[model samples]
Target chain A: EPEVTQTPSHQVTQMGQEVILRCVPISNHLYFYWYRQILGQKVEFLVSFYNNEISEKSEIFDDQFSVERPDGSNFTLKIRSTKLEDSAMYFCASSSDSVTEAFFGQGTRLTVV
Target chain B: GIQVEQSPPDLILQEGANSTLRCNFSDSVNNLQWFHQNPWGQLINLFYIPSGTKQNGRLSATTVATERYSLLYISSSQTTDSGVYFCAVHTGGGNKLTFGTGTQLKVEL
Candidate 1:
């Protein structure tokens, strides 16, 4: 079955550094999203992208975060100046439409020191 | 914003036992999904039952949209079924999913 794939299964970055997490959604999927889960916490939505632009974002998705479908196939989430609290598992998901079931990637474990 | 609450918070079952997990949403939803988070932390999609009933193998799910609650039933469970089950919902015109607290299950011999 076709699946969403994320790059760098794990990443460790220093405080104040920048990190980019990349994802390749299913070939025909159009809506893309970024979500994060802190250890032992529930998953929280960060942002949703459609038509090559962000459709909606949560309060947690502040100035430090940005998402882009830099290419036709790749969607990326960039965090500027990472903080210790930013450490979490980042998941990328995509769906064929807004109300369809979205598929998630394996996720990237971001660790900030 | 909508609120999601999952029941029992945690469960333990013996191999071959059966169990039920529940998810309750505060408002109407356009979509509802059940995901199993494995030990490796991958979210495995189990079902997308916004309403009605759907069964796949030993697992089945039923969502009563009007009641605003969904139930996931696991029959003859196995050790591999040990993990956290999360129910997420899509509300209004938003594309982002609001996830439930999750039900952690541990099936043992």
Candidate 2:
């Protein structure tokens, strides 16, 4: 099965600095999502995007967070300013439909200092 | 939001042993997926069974949607099976996925 791919498997950034996590979703998927998992914690959904617009987002996905599909097949999550608490593994996922199976990427480990 | 609970928070088994893992959901979901997190922290999806049954090699899964539960069976597990098993559910109500705490399995060879 085809899988989603994420860049910069490991990222280390300074607090208050800006960063962008990129993903190339499955070639034929329709919906895109971003989820984060803090070490030893359950995964939490951040936002979902479809048709070039955000469909839903969790409270954790606030003004500081933004997602854009700058071009076909490429999705990105940008954090305006990083925080120490933001250190975690970020996963990207894609589904053929909103209510169906989703393929997840290996994840990008972001360490904010 | 849906509540997902996984039983047997941790397990230890000798290589070539059989084991069963369970997942219970609080509500109805359109889709459910099982994932294994390796020691390196990469999630490898094992199944995407919303209902009924599916098998792959020595692994099999069955979901009784009516009972709101799912079971994963690993026959003759090996040392490679040692990892954290997680179940995630997504209801049509929202795009967010509610995940269980996961079961940490250790297989001793």
Candidate 3:
């Protein structure tokens, strides 16, 4: 079965530095998303991307966050300046359509110090 | 925004036992899915039952769209079933999935 794949299973960055989390969703999927989970908290939606544009974003996806589909296969989330509170597990998911079963990647653990 | 609530925030079960986890949503949804987050923190898709019932091996799920609730049944659970189960829904008019609080299950031998 084809699955979503994320790069750099774990990352450590300075509090004021930038970080880019990359994901390659399933080959034929059309809709992509980014979600984060703070330790011991529920998974929260960040943003959804389709047709090279963001469809919807949550409050957590503020000015510091941006997503890009620079190529046909890569979806990335960039944080301009990381904060201690930004530490969490970031998951990338994709689906064939808005109403289809979305599959998730293993997740990238972002730790800011 | 929609509210997703899961029952029994935590559970402990012995190997070979059976259990049911429930999820309730505040509004109608276009899609409903069940996922298991293992110790490695990977969200594994278990089911995508927006309505009706579907079974996959030891796991089965049922969603009643009109009632706005979904149930996940685990039969003859094993130690490998220990993890956090999350129920997520795609509310009408939105493309993002809203995840529930999750139910943490620990199965011991």
Place model 2 in a CAPRI quality band: medium
Give iRMSD, candidate 1.
0.4
Show the lowest summed lDDT stretch of 10 residues, model 3 chain B: B89-98
Query: Which runs in model 1 stand beyond 4 Å of their true positions?
Result: none
Tens-place lDDT per residue, model 1, B15-107, is 999999999999999999999999999999999999999999999999999999999999999999999999999998788999999999999
- Give the winner by lDDT: 1 or 3: 1
Give the winner by TM-score: 2 or 3: 3
Total clashing residue pairs per candidate?
Answer: 0, 0, 0
Q: Report how far off residue A19 is in candidate 1 (Å).
A: 0.1
What TM-score does structure 1 among the candidates reach?
0.99
- The model with the greatest lDDT is 1
Candidates 1 onward: DockQ, in order: 0.96, 0.79, 0.93
Q: Put down candidate 2 lDDT per residue, A1-113, tens digits, no spaces.
A: 68899998999999999999999999999999999999998888999999999999999999999999999979999997999999999999999998788888989999999
Looking at model 3, residue B10 earns an lDDT score of 99
Q: Return the clash pairs for model 3, or none.
A: none
| Candidate 1, pairs of clashing residues | none
What is the TM-score of chain A, computed separately for every candidate? 0.99, 0.98, 0.99
